[model samples]
Target: MLSDVFGDPATIDETAHLVGEVRLIRTVSRAEAQRTTRFVRHGRA
Candidate 1:
């Protein structure tokens, strides 16, 4: 189960995995979010 592999909340490895998953989702949702919200793009550009 991908969620089981990535959703454990007690290990650093699991936290890192979950963060990566969250980043991917955030990147995908940025466009939609942009339609109604403003965001600051910071970091290596």
Candidate 2:
């Protein structure tokens, strides 16, 4: 999983604990990542 590969160790562990499996979307653009972070923090996409 891309998240499993790219996520911070703590985030990966927490997600694994909750989800039981790590499934992640592959190949996101830098702009997309930045947009996602902004949306997550600001609640607007």
Candidate 3:
């Protein structure tokens, strides 16, 4: 299955998978939290 998805070893492009940095926030404002409250109740944004 690995060979079927990745193809040949020599032809694979490694640079295509470098996705840079990912940031995670620790806090949010009251308005921002209220906006997200509806999504939690209705299962959508």
Candidate 4:
């Protein structure tokens, strides 16, 4: 199963996997958290 999913080495500890998932979630969510509700492009016709 590990080979089918991860392939090659396919050997990560539970803590490492959890940390990777948390990092990815934070990275993906950071853009949304830092975005404003309005567009800011002006005076450029």
Candidate 5:
């Protein structure tokens, strides 16, 4: 899964811990990547 906006290290770590295995890549824009990906977080912080 990917995020729409910027994803900080803490956020990535949290996700990784929950999912058990996750890799986060920082990107300026989706257009920069070949495959489209965006992450929208839940209401619970």
Candidate 6:
């Protein structure tokens, strides 16, 4: 669960509440992050 593109704290909290958990991390590139997240999300990583 990434939060950088989530925008605000309230939105983050709302997402967490609905989605169960959320985590934030620093990445050099948005594309890289998206790729990693997508991989993990599909349980293929």
Q: Which model scores highest in TM-score?
A: 4
Q: lDDT of all the models against the reference? A: 0.70, 0.67, 0.54, 0.63, 0.48, 0.72
lDDT, model 1: 0.70
The lDDT-based order of candidates, best leading, equals 6, 1, 2, 4, 3, 5
Of the candidates numbered 3 and 6, which has the greater TM-score value? Answer: 6
Model 5 residue runs over 4 Å out of place are 1-6, 21-45
Selected candidate, larger TM-score, 1 vs 5 = 1
Q: Score every model by TM-score.
A: 0.45, 0.32, 0.32, 0.46, 0.31, 0.35
* Candidate 2 runs further than 4 Å off: 1-28
Candidate 4 displacement at residue 13 in angstroms: 0.7
- Show pairs that collide, candidate 3: none
The C-alpha RMSD in Å for every predicted model, in order, reads 9.4, 12.6, 9.5, 6.6, 17.1, 12.6
Query: Candidate 6: worst 10 consecutive residues by lDDT?
Result: 19-28
Model 2 lDDT tens row, 1-45: 767675877887786766653232323455679889989899776
Writing each residue's lDDT as its tens digit, candidate 1 over 1-45 gives 656665655565768878999999998898767744543354322
Q: Model 4 reaches what TM-score against the true structure?
A: 0.46
Best by lDDT: 6
TM-score of 5: 0.31
Q: Report the C-alpha displacement of residue 32, candidate 2, in angstroms.
A: 0.3
Checking candidate 5 for backbone clashes, the offending pairs are 2-38, 2-39, 3-39, 4-39
Better of 3 and 5 by lDDT: 3
Model 1 residue 21 distance off true place after TM-score fit, in angstroms: 0.5
- Count the clashes in each prediction: 0, 0, 0, 0, 4, 0
Return the number of clashes found in candidate 4.
Answer: 0
- Per residue, candidate 6 scores C-alpha lDDT tens digits across 1-45 of 456789888998897776553222233466678999999999988
